[model samples]
Target: MNLYQKLVEIRKDVINFSKDTESFGYKYVSGSQAIAKIREKMDDLGVLLVPEVKNTISSTYDYINAKGKECTDHIVSGEMSYKWINSDNPEETLIVPWQLYGAQDDISKAFGSGLTYSERYFILKFFQAPTDVDDPDSRDTSNRGKGNKKGLSEAQVKRGYALGFKAGYDKANVDKQILSKFNKKIQDLTKEEYEIVCNGYEKRGGK
Candidate 1:
């Protein structure tokens, strides 16, 4: 089979949805879990995926956490390209592009988190893995409670709104400010992006 045919098989074989990982009071699939499953399928199907980091930038900032403790955030922004090839016919290949941002207390952890987030999202999206939840774009509001098209978790949204409120901006103002500053809706902000906004708010509250 060619690359497309092999990829279709992988997609068919991969897991749809998993709640093996938990964070901020909700459960979701972890990177390790997703990678393990994908790797197994790829190996069996004679497919290889090679990832290259095209560019990256890093910085650090000091702030206070919600607990009033001083903290430093190490941040990284990066762009990546992944090449998908059929081992049976190495001449045929496909290139996929992705970007990621990571923030953490440690520099190494910041990059690590970004890489983990990138790999998980890249594979899941490339294969079009099912999440078992209703379409995020659907008007149904029932299963829409889990995740949104922007990739923000419900818990993250709640924490962001609460942090913004504590920082002196009400929900509407919070949304307006995020839109103006980040060029993204509050619900559309990436985890790292929202963390930066939240950290900024924490600093304001500290002052």
Candidate 2:
């Protein structure tokens, strides 16, 4: 079998790998999980998968915090490449390109996070793994009582909203001032508006 045929078989086998892990307001298979599964099958098929950072860019911003303390934020972006090699024919290889961005108070954290993020998605996209449903907090409206003062239950909305806010702020690089224009706390945002924010964040590669 050729590289493409082996890859198609691998995708069929692992595409439904359960997203048993959750964090950061999203559900996804971790890099370790995906890699383990992929490596296991690829080895049996006599194929190899390799990932490398092709290039990276880093930037720092200095700003004042709400408490008037000086703060520095570092952002790093990377171009990643994933290679599939056929053992039988050393010359046969396929490459997929991916991009990643991460920001943090520490420069090392920023780059580390960027690399992990890139690798995680690279596995998912390259093999077409399925992500589980949206976070439960974003989906369950059962607690939303009819004619309740708040359209959405506070408890149910809080987790999702917090996740969305952090993702928007961190990954999308959304400005707090833009959110302030909405004139309401995140939990108080109408369902429609809240979804819009979340969607925008994801569109900006928050996920």
Candidate 3:
């Protein structure tokens, strides 16, 4: 089969979430898990997937921690391209673009984190891995009855968890930071407060 045909076959394969890869109280399909499964399929089909970093930009941001102490962190943002090459016909290939971001207190780790985050997300997204989690928009009255509608939305909570993990913070550290700043758990944070938390993570707690 050709590269596209092989990819379509791969897409038809079922990739279940790794129940052991838990973060923020939910199981996710980890990068290694996806790679392992996909790699097997690729080898069977004589297909190759390669990633190339196109460009990256780095900068520093200043922000206040949950302890109200000012801190600076290195942030990296970049684009990468992935190539799907046909093993038999080396000239046949398809390229896809991916945008990624990462932040850390250590300059040495910023770009590495960004690359790893990008690759994980790319694999999951491209493969359409089953996360076994319902979409936030699927809820109608379930959240309304709990009065959680007045607090952070399900989408915001997921985003917060994702950003926190990407920035190399564990669930305990994330909740501790939130509690220190707002005296509330993630589920209790208002939309505005959640925005502050997201800003801290995405923008390195700046401004």
Candidate 4:
């Protein structure tokens, strides 16, 4: 590898690294190895960065490059996968372009000011947000554990109304923000009234 080989992308989302849409899928990339090592002491808490023998920028490019590749395996999310760049020619120099995205919302709502973009948070998010590692295929068909999507979906709205109706004030409080968007009578809506509401949702193109 040359002195210019950047092992990790500065941003958070790896899939966005391509010219158009990247075909390769790589995970467990520590944004910076120094960050990964510092987070390692969390004891099974799964951190992204840490310090190894004090990674200093003042060091030579060769030293930095060597350190990056050497500590590649020590990354907390130990495994990463990507298919051969050219399926037809598996002999090619393993072409896996490392790209990172900062955060989804930052990219979307970012103003022209570069300072605002830099201030945004760094988070690792998957398209479908894969968590399982047991399967060989890249597709995450099974979901054993996961957090709710950052944005609300139709399913989420429906569930919120359902719980509110069933448990009244208790369920309404389950997620106060969501409940607030619901119709005031949502808690009191009966089976028939609920069906009516759902029918309206369907007609309004709820999905």
Candidate that would win on TM-score? 1
Candidate 1 lDDT: 0.70
Write the residue-wise lDDT of candidate 1 on 9-115 in tens digits. Answer: 88886656565776444555667888888888899999999988866666654544446798776666556789999999999999987765567778899888878
- State how far residue 61 of model 3 sits from its true place (Å): 1.4
Stronger candidate by TM-score (1 vs 2): 1
Per-residue lDDT of 1-207 in model 3, one digit per residue for the tens?
888899888877636545457644446666677777788888888889889986555655555553679877776655578888989898999998876566778866877877787787777778776663632222322244344345554334545665665556766788899999999988678666876887788665221
User: Which residue pairs does candidate 2 place in steric collision?
Assistant: none
The TM-score of candidate 4 is 0.15
Candidate 3 global TM-score: 0.63
Candidate 2 — which residues are off by over 4 angstroms? 24-26, 62-70, 135-207
Instruction: Score every model by TM-score.
Output: 0.64, 0.60, 0.63, 0.15
How big is the positional error of residue 124 in model 3, measured in Å on the Cα after superposition? Answer: 1.0
- How does residue 50 of candidate 3 score in lDDT? 89
What digit string (tens of lDDT, one per residue) describes model 4 on residues 1-207? 211121222222333322221122523323343234323332232222211121101100011121255211110001122222222332432322221111112322212121122111122222222322421223331221224322222222333333333233233353453345454434333344444554553333221
lDDT of each: 0.70, 0.65, 0.68, 0.27
How well does candidate 2 score on lDDT at residue 74?
71
Q: Top lDDT: which candidate number?
A: 1
Clash counts for the predictions, in order: 0, 0, 0, 14
Residue 122, candidate 1: alpha-carbon lDDT = 82
